[model samples]
Target: MTQARLRVYILSLFLIATGIAVSTFSAFSLAPLTFQVMGVYWLFSLLYYHLRINSRRGSTSVEYGINYNVSLILFTGPFGLYLFEAVYRLIGYLYKKKTKTDEPGEGVQTFYNVGSFVIQGTAAYYVYQWLIPWFEGNLVAFWVLLFLLVTVTAVVSDLFLLGVFSLLGDIRTRADVAAFLKERSILDMAKTAFSNGLLLLFLEQRNWTAIIGLFVLNYLVSQSYLVKAQSAQDKHERNKYEHMAYTDFLTGLHNRAYMELKMKELEKTKEAIGIVVADIDKFKSINDTYNHSVGDRVIQHFAAALKAKAGTDDILARSGGEEFTMFLRGRSFESCLALVEELRQQIESDAVEAEFQDQTSRIPYTASFGLYFFTEQEEVPIEKGYIYADQLLLESKQLGRNRITVSPGQQHESSLSTS
Candidate 1:
């Protein structure tokens, strides 16, 4: 059976067993007046259930303590709690279906939720019954003991059920489970559990002032959790947008826009910067011969080779189609020339496979390089440096591609080198 169907079957059996236990053991001491009061409160609970606060780990939602409150008061025993929860969840499922198709599916999620409530209620009700008699006259001690016992039992039961479901579901790996737990803040659950415990105690005392204060406090807590969730979501979106803005989707390198910004920033530093502009020698021919997909693979392969050769602090970017630019900060002009020559040799040595008509061919590629160096002391603008480098790049192609050409502007110190 599928996980959902298995869960449904198990939950049906558990509910049936709990129902039998409740019917058999309970005194059912409450009058018709209590039942009537519970029915009215169930309506309030339905609204509260809809106004759920999501757990920080984002694994699930809680009804801002209202579910536990109903379990504590309306249901005097486990059987009553189970029956009330069953009805509550059934109506909730129906209401959700009528409103949105985006909600989690009805089977496993509902089964797990209702099953957890049953377990928590069963354990808590029996424990409270066993302990209440021990401190009957000392109301403060009774409330304190009840709060600690019920909260611990209920929260533990809920977490145990959640762990079981996670193990059985998509979050089975240890890393995924850890991340899931981290996302669903255990502390958040503890806070909610503790707050609900206090609320239940206040309600039992029937102190209207304390009850109202507790409700307000719980509402603020829930709101604070939601606000933090929203803030995190906003930060995630901002980071996503920034990455897209600066990254090249095709090669996963920094794009030209980012490189331009870097260039401007580096200009202010007044450090000597070596610029190496490289272009694939026959990229258009490759794309035309092997198709664009294989061409893309070649581009990715080339990018990998470039990244392998670059230093940790080196700035490399895809300036445009089949073209890339590298800036070597604080490197001499000769070092930059040697770096470009190394890249040329690397590209020529590496071979990529391209498949065509059920036949695969190993293709070796080469790129032409144009090198220039500039510093803040130089009166020449960087734009003019790029233009001069492009002129030498054209000369390299004219002299036969797969070679490096350096500009002669700095030839007073050292002559232009070709590789």
Candidate 2:
């Protein structure tokens, strides 16, 4: 085994042994009522297992199981708590195993979870018992003590789990630790404590019906909220992935895939559109002269300038390395030609400042443009318009670069030079 896995196993074994010793020696009362409560809690936990909400980091999930476990620890002590945890966690481990849904090191994780629960529960039980004498006959002090007990339980549980993760090399830096703690909801912890406090109150009054009814009502409300939360989370994830797919990482412009999709959509409408294919002149020389980093800055600089000239209704994309495509909708052919010419002039004037080695260098660059103006009267494909524009762009390059070659309509072409 790897050293990290070995260390995790050793720790798990140590915790398991220590937990067993503590449970065996701990003084806990297990009445018939305790068994009844345990059975009901287990049943509800099993029913609601799939409904749990995972933390933002997905390291842990939130469930009312903790609230029930807290009540068990207080009501029947560490022994009862251990019994409930052991059986519940074992069933959970087996279910994951059977379904082939267990993550790597699932066995170690199960042991760790059981041991951590027992250790935390046993510590909480002793602390509560120790404080009971001081808070006797004082209702407010007792409530405060109970809340403190919950806090103690949470702190011990988090510390134990974090220590294990550290050993497993999951948390190597202060930022990782911060992220771990950040994903844990303080409000969820407060809710767990409050629920446990209510459960304890109900248990003390021997109101079994109230306990069941309150838990059921809380479960229903939580389920509704969880559904909405899960939906929003799914939507946010979808949008995030879509953005990654469609956006160019270098220039932050729409990528070729998005441009093609837009083209298909526009093709259906058969709208009069202007397509422009632009290429940064001598981009290879820019990278060779400075570095790829400077080249990237140049590309970004060019994209920003092009985006500035594009209308809100127009679509612009980085179709290839040092190549861009623009779709200008709702514009006359003359206006489209004028826009491209203006953009070509702007690019010629602008310079990209880049630091190379220890010196600052201002790099002057220019781009060639190929514009195809498509009218509604033409019986041609949008894809063919892009091809024609690309051909015109090559012709512009051949004509000495820094020029806009325009295909007004059909096969008729004209070249405008800025030599």
Candidate 3:
């Protein structure tokens, strides 16, 4: 448990102790429900905070994440004290997803929400249960008015909270932590929960059956959210694994291993393949002058631009530093060569205005490519496919830095459809 939760637990214990002490000397019978709700809040709040850390991972939608956690806010007990903890967790989560850093005071609204809970819940507790009899001529009328007031308070507070939170519609699940965390100006989760919790006290106290129902409902819904999150994370992890193995991380392009993997996949399918290997022109000179960041940008910008020129079916992976390759999925040797030539021209002509968030100057960069096309007359293994592409890239570099070379293999049987 975090320090904050410990504080909440200690405070709750104090309240329970106070209530018990008060009941010992008076006719007032303390509601066991308050203690039960407080205990539940402590437990769930821990879980909610832990999940908040795990869910801020790559590409998870912020709206979906918030919605995913909403069931907890709805069914939780005690004027939604736990709901406020969820909000604090959410604040941290929003910060990580958007601004990419957890800046100080990023979740001030969350703390304020907790404060609101203390004021409102404490006030309502004293007013409805203690002060009502003093204001009424008849005790029955006092009880009725007290119930009505708490009910209205709960209803109005929930409506106002929903109204206020609706303004967070613009938030996206991007890496902008500071801005997202700071955007909320109104009621936070804690206050909302505390205010809403008033209604639960009027409703019949939940027994084992009700507890079971709440558990099952929350579990099913929360588990569904977890499953979706897990699925998205699984997909991302697979993609990331593939990228790590096959991509040049600095440039975000295919690495040497990627070329080998795709080649093997193609050879297994017995499809015609085009291998175009690319190299940055004057890459060493750029590295020498502007250092690695600019050099890194040159590679990244080139890869991004080249990737823009290719079809979705095409394979473009950075094979090594300043060297890259492309695999055209279902094209003939001749057509694939032609495609590489087009790509080579695009790389030469394209000027990347590589901007630095830290600097004002822009740098220009370019690269060359070699093309090799092959068919299934001979079985091509991963190693052979990669060596062939490497040779072609070397050939292109020897001819000139900014160029493409084609290695024509057996043309595969082409499919035709005429209606």
Q: How does each model score on TM-score?
A: 0.73, 0.74, 0.54
Global lDDT of each candidate: 0.67, 0.80, 0.54
Model 2, position 355, has a per-residue lDDT of 86
Error of 1 at 340 (Å): 2.4
Model 3 misses residue 26 by how many Å? 9.5
- Could you give candidate 2's per-residue lDDT for residues 245-270 as a string of tens digits? 99999999999999999999989987
TM-score of 3: 0.54
Q: Tens digits of per-residue lDDT for model 1 on 1-419?
A: 55555566556646654665467445554666446435644665675664575443344343334445433432455555565666777887877788774355554556656666766666666666677678677957755665555565556554654565564564566786566445544555555556655656655566657755665665566667667877998999999999899999999999999988887777677778777788888889988888898888888888887888778888889987988888787677777777777888888878888786688878778888777787668777666666776777777788788887776656323232333
* Model 1: residues with Cα > 4 Å off, grouped in runs: 1-7, 10-75, 83-112, 127-184, 263-271, 288-291, 309-313, 352-363, 377-384, 411-419
- Lowest summed lDDT across 10 adjacent residues in model 2 is found at 56-65
**Candidate achieving the largest lDDT:** 2
Minimum summed lDDT over a 10-residue window in model 1 is located at 410-419
Top candidate on TM-score is 2
